[model samples]
Every structure is written in C-alpha cells, then in structure tokens.
Target: MSELNTGDSIEELKVTPDKYVPHRYAGATGDFNPIHIDPEFAKMVGLPGSILHGLYVMGLVAKTSAGAAGGDPRALKSLSVQFRGMSFPEQEITITGEVTGVEGDQVTVDVVAAQGDSQVIRNATAVLEIPPG
Candidate 1:
C-alpha cells in the first residue's frame, strides 16, 4: 500500500442508477416506500418523480470510501450523512471524498454525494482503518 497522508484526495466514484434501481433496492431492502418506487405517487406528492432511497445513496458513499481505502470494506469504521435532497433515477450521482485526518490507523474522510449541481448528501463523513503495509 502506498503512504497515505492527511489531505490526500480520494478517487471519485460515480453512479447512474437505472429506472429500476428503486424497485431492485426495494426488493433487496424491503423498503417499499412509494416515493422511491412509484413515479405517479411521487409526482402526486409534488416531487419530480420517484426518488432513490437515501440509504442506497449512502451505501454508494460507503462503498466509495471503502474503495478509497484499498478496497477493503471492513476497513470502514463509521459513516454518517444528512440527506439534503431527493435523487431521481437515471440521474448521475458522483461521490466525492477527501482525507480530512489521519491518526494512527484511523483515516477520517469528508464525503458527499452530488447530482449534477445539487448536493444530495450533505455533512457526510466516513472513518476508515487503513491497514499498514
């Protein structure tokens, strides 16, 4: 493994959920929220359309963080995020992250999810344990 220093930039991960992403996630997670699976219902509720699950987006952030830390998912110790906006299917979501701190084996990162110009996940943070090589 390469040396990791504070202020190191993490590689960005981008995701473009297909139209059936919500349905697939709903089936996998048992979160059948209409806002995430029903376009008409979402529109009726004043949304542009069916929105992606917040947890799904968070999962993307988590995976991205793990990848940044040498692709070991177990290295991720903690993750927190604030869902600030809705994400619709077929929209490109980019996960941006930076190493904010490094203490011993712990690496703290500031992460966010962006949909075009919109910041969908705000105040996102992830802590990972990078194994020494």
Candidate 2:
C-alpha cells in the first residue's frame, strides 16, 4: 500500500505447514473432493498430498497482496488466480507478484507461489481499490 511506482513488485510471502492450505476450507467451500484431504483418495488420483483448495490459494494471494498494497482486503474490487502446480503439505511455499500500476482507485497485482525450484501455483492476480480520501 505504499505509493508504489508503476511496475513495482512487492516482497514474497513465506508459507508453512499450517498454511499448507485446503484443510477444512475445502469442506467449508464445499469442494470436498477427498483428494484435498484424504491421503488414500489423493493417491487414488496420483496426487502428492491433500492439495490446497484453489480458492484458498487465491485468498492467500489476495490477502498478501492487499497487505503489501496497504489496503484492506475487504475493499478489494476483483481477484483471480489460475491453478498451475499442486502444493504439497510441509513444503515451504512462497507467493510473489507485482503492481501493474493503478487503475483509478484500484491497484493491480500479478502473483504466484513456488516450492523450492518447482512452481506449485501460477497466473495469480489481485485487484483492489485504494482508500478514498
């Protein structure tokens, strides 16, 4: 939320096990496909582990971006992200993005997350409106 110059990128977010994602959120979001929680079910489909819910991924990205932009997450205008790679539990993850500048009162961000050298998520973006004076 600092006065970012056009094209300025924000610092990346460090993720951990508790934040590994999905969890009960899948159930809360009604996306309870065992692959996101059950190991056996995940293995049945060849997943590494119960992966985080796609929307949860977006939430993390959006919240982090909002914090970076110095804006309230509740005031966001639009937010979206595309699934790229599967995020595994216990793996260290990082989320990063850039400010594509502002549009009127809105701020734009392009973001993604990675584990080690592997990209676990991609095509992330967040749009938020600046607080009115």
The reply for model 1, stretches above 4 Å from the true place, is none
TM-score of 2: 0.82
| Model 1, span 1-133: residue lDDT tens | 5656788878899889999999999999999999998889999999998999999999999998998877897899999999998888998999989888999999999998999899999799999998788
lDDT of each: 0.91, 0.72
Best by TM-score: 1
Clashing pairs in 2: 1-68, 1-69, 1-70
Against the true structure, whose lDDT is highest?
1
TM-score of every model versus the real structure: 0.96, 0.82
The 10 consecutive residues of candidate 1 with the worst lDDT sum are 1-10
lDDT of 2 by residue, 1-133 (tens): 4665568877778877563256668657878778777877888888866776666666677777877656465756777767777776667778888888776777787888777887766777677677655
Task: Mark the 10 consecutive residues where model 2 has the least summed lDDT.
Answer: 15-24
Query: In candidate 1, which residue pairs clash?
Result: none
